[model samples]
Target: MTDSLQNLVSPEEWQARIDLAAAYRLVALYGWDDLIFTHISIKIPGTEHFLINPYGMMFEEITASSLVKINLSGEKVSESPYPVNPAGFTIHSCVHAARHDAQCVMHTHSINGVSVSAQKNGVLPLSQQSFFVLSSLAYHDYEGVALLEDEKPRLVHDLGDKRFLMLRNHGLLTVGSSVAEAFLGMYIFEATCMIQVRAQSGGGELVLIPQKILDMAPAQITQVTLGMGGSLAWPALLRKLDRVNPGYRS
Candidate 1:
């Protein structure tokens, strides 16, 4: 099945599948998955098509050949032995439709993330990681589970060109030019929230990063990464995955 699926798509798309599948496994490895809930979607480059997880599969169980290909409407466009979660597509499809630059969209219902989302201040500039998120964060008040088409417009409006989105009373989301980029963004986002939650529990006065430094984070990060950003760490991440969870590439 793996070989057959690999043969069915272009080399570009197959690589996309492997990267996205690896992302799902990495999410699980980090203990961020929510019992088969939430989603990470990657748009097939230069096409309106997308690849999403098969419904009912744990993130650790997702493989390159098991991802289901679908069109913008969330309807399956390929012959797969699995079904998709239509409700999951509500957020992903909307993001893909509105943000052409977002080749990958990742959403998570992580405990630390949701805890931060429920906070009135959202992501505060409490740590260096927070600076990366605050520099590009947006917020959307949760309007129930994202299962309606009408909600898409409001969700898109709230996202509005931002890379990180805090779904109030819900979770965290990040969009990027690739699976690696999106995953890295989420890592920073989740770390920010975790630090915030821990700091709040400490009952000590939290010293925020100065506004000037916070403002300079984006440019500093660009320089530090030499413009490679997530791609710089992606190969290493893949190697880690290969050692810890090896089946995603299949």
Candidate 2:
């Protein structure tokens, strides 16, 4: 489908496609994709439009040229032989509408993520990675399968100025200024959930991080990650993908 459009889009839009497609591939690589159920979206550079996975394709099967471009209204801007899940658009559009900083929005129904979401405590600060998440985390109570337009306001309200969101009884969500940041944030968020779940299995008292330390996390995060930013590790990830399955870049 993207074959004929190669001469149609600007270079920047095409690059957005490659990176966004890489994100989908990475999600599948880490087993976060919910068998074509969950969605990840990226706003096109210098435009109000965004690119999302074509409905009905497995994450691993998604290619750069095959991504569907849509406006804030969930209407398609690109020609494609696929349909999109309105539920996916409903959730993504709301957040994109409110958060100007979030160029990429990623949602996952990973097992560990949903496990922690259902917990009354939500995300706990039991692991080192949890600190970074807690520094910018928010929680939204689940309100069914994300199809209603009215629910958009509440979801954006709960997500106010936050990068990480735990949808109670649903799953995990991360928004980023870029695709790499969103993917990296989800990686940590999912890992934190996995660690917390395993820690609870021993039935031992969970020693929580002190509030003072949590307060310092927002400032120390760059130092902790050595100022790599989110995309620092992205090249390595893409290289890894290339070794295993390079078709996503097509």
Candidate 3:
């Protein structure tokens, strides 16, 4: 299957295929999958075409060759045996259209993500993880299940330059200039939500990180991680996926 894909797709596209497939597998690996409900889209380098998981396949079942390529209008630019969900692509399409700097868009409905989204106060500065998320977080009020065309502007408007987006009353979304960044951003975002929910469940007074400290999160994070972005951590994640689900590369 990989050989077939290599013959059919350009080298860059094939790598994108593998990276996107790995993301699907990782999403499922971390138990973030919603049984084929959420979608992840990545723009193909040097083209307007983007790749998404084919509808009906669980995230764990996605593979490099199995992904479907579609244009911004949700139209398939290449032949794919699988179909894409128009309704699911609605929010994804809008984000990619508005954030040209964003090369990858990831949407998830992890239990904690939705739980926190429904909260009166979204993400708070309680834990160190929250610092990274709060630094670039934005919230968009839910506008019903199906994302209408008019809603595109408002959604993008809310997202602005933020990497983390909380779809109020709905779920969570992340955007990145690369697949690695989006996945890494989502890891922090999702973890922040899970930790916050559990910490609050203790029903005791919580100590909050000072707002001034949070203001230095960007520099601190870079220092803590040795100035390495998601790229530095992504290979290790893929190796973990290979140990559990090597089929994603197919």
Candidate 4:
């Protein structure tokens, strides 16, 4: 590891690393991971730094020790043999910089996510799963692979004051104050898209929930789940990951 990472490894940082690694593994297990393409990153505790997956490793191969420490500019603060991906960090860094409440940022290019993103209406309120996402979601049109520095302002602008962002014709993103929150947000977002896609495939009129009801969805969802959607779901996902790929924590 780099001296920067050596000095940075505290209890909180280790926890962040382990949780982020577990998230990567779990996303892979759920089929949300797109090879080594998409990324999930967590802010380094007590610093402006963040932890991200190394460039070449598949999600299942990401151990806590393997995650690279990087700053907003995407330079690897960790002394790993692997390099960091500047393109991947571009999307993540914009959210982290714009949303101080966001400690973890998860992005994915899953087929379901891309499918929904391509639709002109974006995320329609077609299911219960859609309510959780529609209440606080935003959309950003794809700018041809997210590598340009010029795109940051518009991307952040489109994501203003929202936890979830659907990249038009691209993929999905969720930001949270904790890894669990971000992971759970993505879970709900992906489920909404999957359900919509499956429902549309039925070739019948979608039973979209009314706008008035959708307006009350955030509170209603909280009431139904007792605000434990993340708290409850995250552990179960971890257990699933443990069964399939327990080395993430190591």
User: By TM-score, who's the top model here?
Assistant: 1
TM-score of each: 0.97, 0.96, 0.96, 0.95
lDDT of 1 at 201: 99
lDDT of 2 by residue, 1-250 (tens): 4463456789888888888889999999898889989899999989999899899999998998889989998889767888977678888998998998889999999999999999998988898889889999999998898988899999999999988999999899999988988999999999999999999998999899999999998779877674326868888888999998797777
lDDT of 1 by residue, 97-215 (tens): 99998999999999999999999989988988898888899999989999999999999999999999999999999999999999999999999999999999999998988988887
The number of the candidate with the highest lDDT is: 1
- For 24-94, candidate 4 gives per-residue lDDT tens digits of 98898889999998899999889988999989999988888889889999998757777899888999998
Global lDDT for candidate 4?
0.89
Model 4: clashing residue pairs?
A: 2-79
> Candidate 3 at 90: error in angstroms?
1.0
Candidate 2 total steric clashes: 0
- The alpha-carbon deviation from the true structure for residue 71 of candidate 2, after best TM-score superposition, in angstroms, is 1.2
Residues 1-250, model 3: lDDT tens digits: 3234768888899899999999999999999999989899999999999999989998988899999999998888888778888889999999998899889999999999999999989998989789999888999998998558999899999999999999998899999989999999999999999999999999999999998999998898788874326888999999999898998877
Evaluate residue 218 in candidate 3 and report its C-alpha lDDT on the 0 to 100 scale. 81
Tell me model 2's lDDT, rounded to 2 decimals. 0.89
| lDDT accuracy of residue 125 in candidate 3 | 94
Q: Which ten residues in a row have the lowest lDDT in candidate 3?
A: 1-10
Candidate 3 Cα deviation (angstroms), residue 135: 0.6
Cα misplacement distance, residue 83 of candidate 3 (Å) = 0.8
Worst 10 residues of 1 by lDDT: 1-10
lDDT of the structure predicted as candidate 3: 0.90
